[model samples]
Target chain A: MSSNSSFPKNEISIIRGKCLVLPGNDIDTDRIIPARFLKCVSFTNLGGQVFADDRSELKGAHPFDQKQNYGASILVVNDNFGCGSSREHAPQALMRWGIRALIGQSFAEIFYSNCLSLGIPCATGSEHLIKDLQKTIEADKSQVWELNLKHENIKSSENTFNLTLETGPLKMLLTGKWDATSQLISQKKNIEKTKKSIPYLSNFDITN
Target chain B: MSKGTLYDKVWDIHRVADLPGGSAQLFIGLHLIHEVTSPQAFAALEEKNLPVICPERTVATVDHIVPTISQKRPFNDPLAEEMLSTLETNCAKHKIKLFGIGSGSQGIVHVIAPELGLTQPGMTIACGDSHTSTHGAFGAIAFGIGTSQVRDVLASQSLAMNKLKVRRIWFDGQLKSGVYAKDLILHVIRSLGVKGGVGYAYEFAGPAIKKLSMEERMTICNMAIEGGARCGYINPDQTTYNYIQGLPHAPNFEDWTKAINWWQTLASDTSAIFDDEVTFDASQIAPTVTWGITPAQGIGINECIPTSESLETNERLLAEEAFSYMDLKPGKLISGIPVDVCFIGSCTNGRLSDLRAAAAVAQGRHVANGIKAFVVPGSERVARAAEKEGIDRIFLEAGFEWREPGCSMCLAMNPDKLIGRQISASSSNRNFKGRQGSAHGRTLLMSPAMVAAAAIEGKVTDVRKMLGSIK
Candidate 1:
């Protein structure tokens, strides 16, 4: 609910459309994309392998197997999602799978930031609320949860939850002003300010 | 007389300037790099036509993509080979020391740094890997960086960053028999929830931490990221000094005195302030494993998986998914969940001590039939050390494949994998769906000893049964 109109508005970015919610918290990066696939620098082919080693033994119908969910957009996850490893590939894979946004009780700090940097919107809510939304989706596979990024809210049936974002990060996402290097680039002027404030840093020979 | 906490002291000493926003531009004292994440950062440097500014302050290693089966040039995977080559070339060109495959010190970057004494107290360390916090066992401040940030470090030898508020996690009491560092951390993660450490660095202190060996301390710190903290560290103490005393990169006698003094100043003052504080009783922890697919979903081996009715609405559905994926019953005890494989290697628990712990459990008992158990040393040095101690023979004799050094089944690199929804008891961190290289594969994270016990039993079981008098 900021005055600035920076993020893409109104369009619902669905992540994983797969409706596949792994139970529990601390779902780590290694489980998202086994280290085998990490050798490739490009994220293009990683989506196909997302949970590759994990899905093969399913007895019958599983979420990833549904052709319709193959292109599902929203990723509804459990509490404390994306734990373990700073591997950005975890988010990259989820994104490539067409995940536009994730609604979870919470997210791993680095993974959440990585998602934001890649333009994937992540929203957090109470564990009880997120669980309700996840259950609603599970009960009806076709059910869709609506997220209003501009309003910083999400709705599943009659239940609604607010999303939390720290001030500076919210501004960047809302204004579409996020360029990974842009923050540092803009800080060039501040680097000079820093030097003047902490003169001792100037004497530390960085060239060594 | 205000005594600053370790976090406050470190923050104050390292603080360069607070940014206009809430972040800090704290300086980095040492940087470590690995083949996987550094290649692109090095490429970025090439694009900028820049030379590494402080090669002496940086160390590099090959770990992630190295094959645990063979120690040869040019890996079978073309992509893995290229990444290895890129790191070698980048380090050679930059004059940054790299521990290549088969190098005496070559191992997981985190393990190699501490083993070589490259990580020290009162320094801020950065790496492209999250486990870089492992160096914090030496009382240094360490953080993981992204590819762009890796470039920032290589080009300028500094990172533009925010200062983190520190949370002092004071653990009291002594660990009961069979409880390891892995269990202690898992317990902490469960209590705090995985996101509890967000926006903070965790300072692990108190008598329990002070009593643990340096390697055990590393295991605890290595998983700080898993708990949502950017980094976790322990203050330098007698255990720390003793561990580094004769190591390769540690200071000499003349410098040792000065180094210890500086290290002493790095500890949190008794009156130091913290953004938050939490405490745990070491006696409350137990050998734990994930009942569901996530680390935080874990309970002690003796516990049962929670029913949907026991979980929050959002968590219930995930529990349902876990039930189907893990093929487990909600009310059943997690103690005997069948395991198809066992893996004991990764940055999290792949050091020599980890191997020794697992070896002790596997020494006399053979791995269960149909269970593919393996032991992958985190580095060549660890492998060599294990060999010198005949730990390899112990593992091999017990039916666990003693493989070459590298992250093996831990993340399913190099073909050491789980197949057809196989469930594994893993010492390496994490237990996410398909984290072991198969779509339906499941992982149960546990202590190395517990992993060994499960490997032999072919099911989740308390390691205490196998421990039998070993404390």
Candidate 2:
């Protein structure tokens, strides 16, 4: 019952919120945030536009358009969510739309990395567990679910389900190193050394 | 756990340091940026007060949002104009090279880099766009990073990342005539589900791959992300060397020999172990097209869409969703599906070779009445070279509009977009719902030649029949 705490490390370790289940496999980024809306120089107003096309097509019947689903922070989805384009806007739009974490059967590689960059945790579970969670969330949208990174399990009032997260990303998320700019810069010496060692950099002056 | 593969070799060479988390920091050798994704990253760098660590290694281009109809300054779409100008200001302030609009060298980031010889073997490339994997055709490891990683590259010239295993997709036989590289890749994505390449880098090898032209190889690697792999590569060979030998930014004559020597060693060893391997008979693949939204929802031209009973349980949901969204039904053949639009350009199949192949189909045929058709070259160099060969004249005479390049209608960031419920035959990579702009628009993914064939017929026609006639 007490497993959903992130006090010691305290950096994007645990994310708690009402969960919204988007039931579909291979839901792509284009559907999440269409390219037509990507003309802006900033992502500031993307929240209102998240899933605009989908919501419009559904004509207020979409889960996103449902008043009950509003204010949900955890997005529960089926396999391969965020499966197209490397647009961070997809996740940025979702984040702005109030999603802070996601639990899915699987996710696309670039999308997972993008979510990590924004300090949003994407946890994976087995097919059975993910399906069960989606069903559970849809049944009770009012209840809150907690995603505890340190514990590596999602907690609901009724049950605790383990989630799969690679050690590299899990540790980074827990330690607040998911925003990797500073960590990458800390390896400046190593970067310079590797740069010096690259044969092309030294062998030619083919600067574009 | 893959060993001695090109992926392993590149990772070993670029490995900088292992960080606190189990991730390693690898320096990016080449960083490509564009108008749509660079502004926020530049702003982040400014907020952090960090300069571009290696300005010379980064190159910028204005695409995605540029109007193919007319790339005039002060674009009609103010948001787009602001985005492009922001990239220009940022590149100038950061001392980065930008191939702005009308810069003969300016084009899609992926196309321009390869044409200018910035993409080479044994290098690491990073771009904010997913198709950055296109550069992997040169035997380099390329990553499709988000904007924040773009900021990291701008600030430190490096990224903290977990490594990926290598999957060797070996094609045993040659592709059948008219069954192009696009077909082969679409077949690969269909054989292995779109999520199949997750957590792995794909090494495209074997005899069939070895015989492809450099441009053809780029087409395959360009869509690697569509198959879910962030990186895909082929070992550098004479074909690769020939392509890079004398390009504008390629190694000078003095260093060419040395560069070749190093590149040759980057290929996997004879006994190289792979995390996983799959063999496909290229000759067995047919002209492929996606009937559903996802790239993996593809079948041979002669094949019917699978019924729910035929799909994997996990795949059924998306299939149902696709069937509804695309207004397609199960058990219907993908061929002869009427299309409203035919677009023949994108990072996936927008190179000169792609244009030439599509032109051959359009050479003696006019597009079907009432079908809107157009051709957009991949880059400025491609457009000029194609025009020099009078490819543009062939398209224009065939009743297809010949337009400028810039990812037009592929992602539909500009005015070139599908209207409501318009179905498109596209050479671009994705076919997601609303991908081509209109909420109800549908797309069929195929080779550029097939796109040309579809335009001529106003339906999805098999290119093999048209090619057979040409001979």
Candidate 3:
């Protein structure tokens, strides 16, 4: 079973095929989903608008408009991926576009967190590795690339790459330990117990 | 034997108790809120039947979802109207100060804080919005919190949190001509990467930082989140005191002297201890732009789109996607890439100064043939100030729409949006895919001047080239 992790994770979804890669830095949220569709309060229904501006600019020739990659999920990108404002919508739009995982050298703090919360895995590697994977895929889109989520590896014919994950967030996502918040919640007893020790925090009934 | 750093001093002063879980029950001196994320928190308060324990310690405003154009009654978006009404009602009910549209004091949460002197040295501030860290520019410890925590603040005026390690980022040398605080921050984020500041509060120090104007400091701290820092701050100095001197919320004459002395004492000692330290050269920074999905994914104006070969394995796929979506080939210079729209406004760069900078460039020129561009002020006051200087006319004449104040197109909570993959040069923060309100809408983040240059060229062009011509 594939684990859902949002923080840059070594465990990646192994897509046993070459995926189309895009190369732009600072590809902002607007290009992922246009503002016109943001009026909807729900992230689930904004799927069609993913890459709204980019799709329109391509005049139906964009890959997002094509039916071939409808459910294709992997997205490889440049450094500072998801930079700009702290809107969680950027990742929400991408997740809806069926982008299950993002491969990039870096990610915006907010965007990366949002992706993690949504079970979307983002991985980071060196610039050289990113470029090699891109060239290999650009030369042969038909070749399947493997992004092994459990193994923390990206396997291509030419090279295999290992990645690092921040321990705190990784543990939370790997075992459905979406329980960190719950742990915080359960700390109510501990909080109360400590209230006696620290009269200031307890004076206000800080416990939830 | 250690001279405490600003972070260390502030953290120690605010630390109420160190709990068993290693988190500190830091005493919050001030908390700010806005309509977007507070409704739910207020509702949570209602559910708990809690009263605002310290209404005087909190401030509220409406920025997000407020239409920049015609912020009239019953906003065009029904939900926005509801949010406004709810915030208005909530503030009234809680006795918390609410800065509504048209109030002279009503501005971006971050902007109003400094301008009114509500943010002061050594205070710990928290807001529901991430950019709340903007207040840290004053040497205050600030954090952006979640909704439940918002409820906690409303109920107790304090939050339970862990102390963060402090990283001292020292910028040496003076910034060169044409370089502004925006460029400096972009440079910092680019060098540190977005996550470099994680688990730390960045104390921006050294000669270069000390010389910056308060507004410039705000801009530097504004993007602290980009560097993955919980907050970025400079010790409050004469510049900070001068900026806050006569504001409505500032300490009056008698209190002013006392406040200044207190503020002076808050500066980090010469021998401050820091968990970590990073250094950068001021001269090395250049006019930067985000070429891909993230703020960290940036390149110098003349740099080329990264090819897969230059990136890591995980980045390869995104690079390929960026190349295709942005319709740029690898190694192609980003400077001449055609842009379809130019947007300026957001908490990031929607102040009066940002508007003037962009307007100066747009004054005698028109937006390029096929480009769509506009300026949205961060607040009503900002819009009015821009109009007072006729910056609005310059933008209008230059083919950019002059919208009212609010967080527009920046996150597309309102009508402004990219229709379909329209490449834009935006001055607002964040360039994540679809961040500007369209799923595939391409966004390039740059300083307001850079956005102006791109608007004129219909592509990403260097602002320095046209700086002289614009003036």
Complex DockQ per candidate? 0.26, 0.60, 0.14
Pick the winner on DockQ between candidates 2 and 3.
2
Per-candidate clashes, comma-separated:
42, 0, 106
lDDT of 3 by residue, B443-466 (tens): 888999899989998888888879
- Tens digits of per-residue lDDT, candidate 1, B1-471, equal 123766666555555555443455565668898887777677777877877766877898887778888768778878788888888888888898988876688888888889888888767889988878888888888988766677777766655555677898999998888899999998888777667798789999888998999999999998887778888999898889899998898877666776676677677777788888898999888888887776667888778888999887746766787898889899999898888888998888888888988888888789998998888888888888889999999999999888887767766656687897788888877676776777678888899989999999989988887887432
Candidate 1 vs 2: which has more DockQ: 2
Q: Give a tens-digit lDDT track for model 3, residues A61-98.
A: 77666544444567888766664444455676666656
lDDT of 3 at B279: 90
RMSD of each: 5.6, 3.1, 7.4
- Flag the better candidate by TM-score, 1 or 3: 1
Instruction: State the lDDT at A29 in candidate 2.
Output: 91
Model 2 residue runs over 4 Å out of place are A1-10, A204-208, B469-471
Q: Per-residue lDDT of B282-381 in model 2, one digit per residue for the tens?
A: 9899999999999999999989989888998877877888898888889988888999999999888889999999999999899999999999998898
Docking class of 3: incorrect
- Worst lDDT 10-window in candidate 3 chain B: B16-25
Model 1 TM: 0.83
